[model samples]
Target chain A: MTQYTAVHGEKVSLLRVLGPGHVWALGVGIVLVGEYMGWNFAVGKGGALAALIACWAAGMLYTCVAMIDSEVTSTVAAAGGQYAQAKHIVGPLMAFNVGLFLVFAYTMLEAANAITLGYLVQTVGGMAGFADTHDKPFIVLTIMFLAFLNYRGVYATLTFNLVITAIAFVAILILFAAVSPWTDNVLKPHELLNGLPYGWLGVLAAMHFGMWYYLGIEGTTQAAEEVRSPARALPLGTMTGIITLLIAATMTWYICSGLMPWEYLGQAVTPLFDAARLTGSTPLMVLLFVGTIFSTLASANGCINDASRAWFSMGRDRYLPQVFGAVHPKYRTPFRSIVFLVPVALVFAYFAPLDQVITFSILSGLLEYTFMAFNVLMFRKMWPLGTIKRGYVHPFHPLPAFVLLALCATTYFAVFLGYGTQLVAMMVFYIIASVWFAGHRYKFVKRGAQFTMPWPRPVGH
Target chain B: MENLNNFQLLEYAAWGISALLGLWMLTDMIRTNRAHSEETLLSSKEGEIEDSLVIDPPHQGGHL
Candidate 1:
């Protein structure tokens, strides 16, 4: 407690203003958009039951992620998430690549959310008899609005996220209740269930899309610097967040699959909105309409927050540029990094088609997940158990790491099966970026200063 | 421009506002860079320090 107070007396930085609830909001908010739209692409690959299997399988993968992250982040206690982990446990090049993965993955997700918001607005305009409305302005405005929330401060941004995320989660429950699968209601799972139209291979293929269900829950660690008690808050918020998303994901699949045919549900742009429409209830449709809009906004807002933190940490260590490391004096936010990534996200949002935007985001996320498994193994082997105090330590030893690696490999293969060209292209982009960073950026980083966390020396050396 | 409908005009308004906000953020960032020294703004020593709540593991050896 004395040490905590001592550290706060003299630094200009991100405010220690977040709690467990903010952590939950940040994690869940980024992911709840999948419940509204993106996860149905799994249904496209497999049938309904296969998609459900993919959902739980993907859920198992993220569960391992949340566990491994809790242990490392609780001890590492830095803002860069896996980037910081790599810096300490892995090497400079891997840390640099992990940084790029976090930045691109979240930035692309932000773009996807912005794109979805634009389309949803145009959809509303179409229904209101404005036939020729453009989506570009709406896209730009959505990004700008969330950017303002993030720029102003962390507390307001996440609190707003909490409200919108709760509304979106509840809209799914409301749709579930209105349909009332318990009684004889609108859901017809018996009639609508298609038995693995693409067969077992389809279930394997669907695993990648199943990831959309709880994609960014591990992002809770990015707020490590902001949390008042990271050990308690990080695990509490993250564990609860995973539970919320699993329930929301299962309910979303059940309702959408029961309400609409698996064939149509696979391709629907706004599946939750479409599910409400299928029930012939105007009120439910209105609720879902607003729910979809809010979820996208919340997601984009959370992405900006996480992406900027990863970039800012790298910049602070001179991994990018010192300019982006500057924190705003009054707001105590990473103002420069937040502003720098705006146009990058904006370009991708404004130009890329939404599905392509989402595919890019998922592939990037899968790559980041691959890094986590190796990271924990290195940390445990180098530091060993009880070498340094941990805020929270994950149980089950190396089992989680092994499980995470196997799942990540399977998902990578699944992604390759569906998107071989895009997968290769994204890998090429990262390799090119890596070469540039090693030649240009890595030269400037202060190697010793980067090791700021006060821990005993590693076991070997 | 005159051929545009009410909805189209509103669409342009949204774009204009987005541009304004974007410009505002950039200028604010630039202003911030000038108002503070690089070290002052970048000094985030606390960010690297483990919060006291995360105690070191029971020791065969103590933490740094």
Candidate 2:
């Protein structure tokens, strides 16, 4: 007979699963690429002061949502993540919607990253004489590479990320220091605020752009269960990750604005790479290229892994399909979900342009964030914990949560209104998810099946 | 330098720190993983429970 521990076994410790360093690396990896791509544009349009404030606001808002997730859910495994959490709190249908949105958004992100990676390779390949290749072949190769690495499992993926993140971090610092002499000439107040559409509406629109940099704050929570001491580590690790990224992003923005002319910076195709070139170091340019490529790959890998886990969790719960729930018996990874995600990403990659893919991804993410913020408030009210844990809490409580919800909702509508095609796409996504849920429910009823949370049973009962 | 401004200094510092921190994080990952095997072995013997059970059953309308 096979031996099994009681369901209510000992709880895992954080130190064992995710060391402080790995957690930090994971946080840095998520923010670096997005900021590298868009920070200059955001700061130049909003002004340093405005950008800084927005970064803080958005970061804190994201952090609150993550903490609520950690507190409300018992375990922080990568597989179930937000979809599972939402399912537990609300009903299956809402949970299914969250899963659907997340899968769609993340798949779009994979496509975007692949395209961007192609562009990056083309840019750098110019130096190495490979010549520029367009979308299809590059996208296919990139997807295959990421899939292979992810399939190798989390350790390999994370290890690769750590190395790449380190190199990129060094390149960024060197570029910043080398260009330090040009700061005064580049830092113009009007440059910061110019090129913006106009007024408060423009600023609000700009905030939507800023939200891109803060995209993965809640992602760390998805890995909660994978980390050892989830109850303690999930909250602390996530908050620590967020705060660190906020500071890093803010500083990077300020430096980029100070070191390069905002007008020129906004128009540049490879802003960070260009910044490195301006530093008068050819080696720095190469470093920047490598760093950027690494950051993009790392971010793509993390997104695919986390997203696949969310889908798998939903699938296990019967909100999706049972196939997603099937863990690789030996690897102990969600192989089926990963398999499902890769082809969907490939299809999107083949058809969608990178910019459109990114915009759609952001729009979907905002809707999820709106629901997440609302979930936080609902969780706080419905399930009050007398003792607040060591993790950071929003100072304003319901107000901050409420404000974030309203802002996220407003941002979603604004984006939807501004982009007609994306709005239509969003509608189609919702409809598809609804139809899927109805079908799932019907099947469940036909089989006389009931849904239940995946939990540890009490020891020896 | 009259040409250089606060914005530039902040940017330099930010990038500088990111590089340093990134490098540190990498080193830490490698170092910790080396030590981790033994620690994991010890902990596995402790027979700790999974975190999933902490949730009040899903029927109670709690996040699992």
Candidate 3:
């Protein structure tokens, strides 16, 4: 009977083993790697000031996201994150698209992280005169090892993520302290700072890369069903995760902008690591190197855990296939889904260009945000606040929703400024996926069975 | 596959590890499938419950 609804406390479902701390780890783990590497691309686009503005701008977008996501995820409390929210709040077609967005976003990010891990190994080998070292082996090892941990259980997977994420985060703070000393300041913001080089257009262009600051932070809710208490842990974990990212992103931009001139800062492959090297501290360099490697590993690990869950949630509803929905008897995990998505991630990790792969990921995420903006608005209209018990109500009723839509539109335009072709390509990709789901697949979904949450019947229904 | 460099050999080893883990997951899943029905795997019903026995204590009353 409970199989019909996303009924909590089921023995066969994903285990309720995660706490707020683990949720923090999952969300932070995914996004911290961005700080260590890609966010500098914003500097390259706009200049130091543009990068900073875009960082906070994207931060504002994610703050609205975290607040809105917490409210919806708290009420819905399922595994697929926004996919679950869209299913419960909107309908099947929207839910199907959200699920695809999540799977592709995380899978692409996973592949990107895996590729970074392999390249980091090659860099290390180059330092050791083993310049011919192969990165393919490391990539394989990363995907396989992380998959194994996820296959084992959530507790182990997130616990492992927490340690490495914490280390990577501390490395950033240490860099900040070392560079920002009063009399002997290493970070010459006065010297490196150039007011927006490309002007407003550059600032807009920077917004797309600025998203890296907090892109995957919202993924904490993907483990919603598995959290010990969705109401408590969801808000606690997601909010704290955002706050951590805000601090980290600010420090990362400050440190990087000061150490390297805008031209070099914008293009450095590992900006934080490069900043550490510029300090002439071998200890900091090695620590940043390790930090970069660990952050990438943690990111890949979290991505596997998340991407598989989204795929599993879709499978459970027969949105794809029921076979992909099975929980492992002993592990209490979406084992089949984990197994199925591994090869897809590996294929991209091995072959695809990172820049294009990332554009698809960010665009997919942007599409989901578009769905979320409307989903939350509809949620309020259908359920009405105080009609149902909510764990956290975001302050200011429709402000967050309206702001989210505006931010999403702005980000989509920002994406268009740079990744215009990919933006069109992604829209085409999801549109086709949507049409296929609606035309060929909607018959399989049991709409009546889906709305079994304990909340009161929606106002109109 | 002949005359592979050390790095190429390492790649083979990594793939080998991945294959072993993959095969292990597959076989373990197969074992679980054989032991339980698809319905039990997908449903909330504890499929392992059938292997249990509720041992009834001979009431600890005045006889003790």
On TM-score, the candidate that comes out on top is 1
* TM-score of each candidate structure, all chains considered together: 0.93, 0.76, 0.92
Q: By the DockQ metric, which is better: model 2 or model 3?
A: 3
How would you encode candidate 3's per-residue C-alpha lDDT over A1-461 as one tens digit per residue? 01121223333556666789889999999999999999999988899899999998889889999999999888888888898898888988888999999999999999999988898877776776644677888888899889988987788799899999999999988888888646446868887797988999999989999999998988998988777788899899999999999999999988888788989888889999998889999999989998999999989999999999999888888899878878875676788899899899999999999898888889888988888889989999999989999989988979988888898888888888888988887789888988899898889986676665777889999
Kindly list the per-residue Cα lDDT of model 1 for residues A1-461, writing each as its tens digit: 11121122344667677889999999999999989988998998898898899999999999999988988998877888889889989989999999998998899999999888888888778878887888889999988978877897788888899899999999999998889979756888989997998889999999988999999898898998887788789988998899999999999999999988888988889899999999999999999998998888989999999999999999888889877777776666899889888899999997788767877888888888899999999899989987898878898979999999999999999999988999999999999999998898888998888988788999898
Report the error of model 3 at residue A113, Å: 0.4
Of candidate 2 chain A, the 10-residue stretch with the lowest lDDT total is A6-15
- Residue-by-residue lDDT tens digits, candidate 2, A313-343: 6665556555455443223345567766877
Chain A alone, TM-score for each of the models? Answer: 0.96, 0.84, 0.96
TM-score ranking, high to low: 1, 3, 2
DockQ-based class of model 2: incorrect
Q: Give the C-alpha miss distance for residue A210 in model 3, angstroms.
A: 0.2
Evaluate all candidate structures by whole-model CA lDDT and list the values in order: 0.86, 0.59, 0.84
**Can you give the lDDT of residue A206 in candidate 3?**
91
TM-score of 2: 0.76
Ranked candidates, highest DockQ first: 1, 3, 2
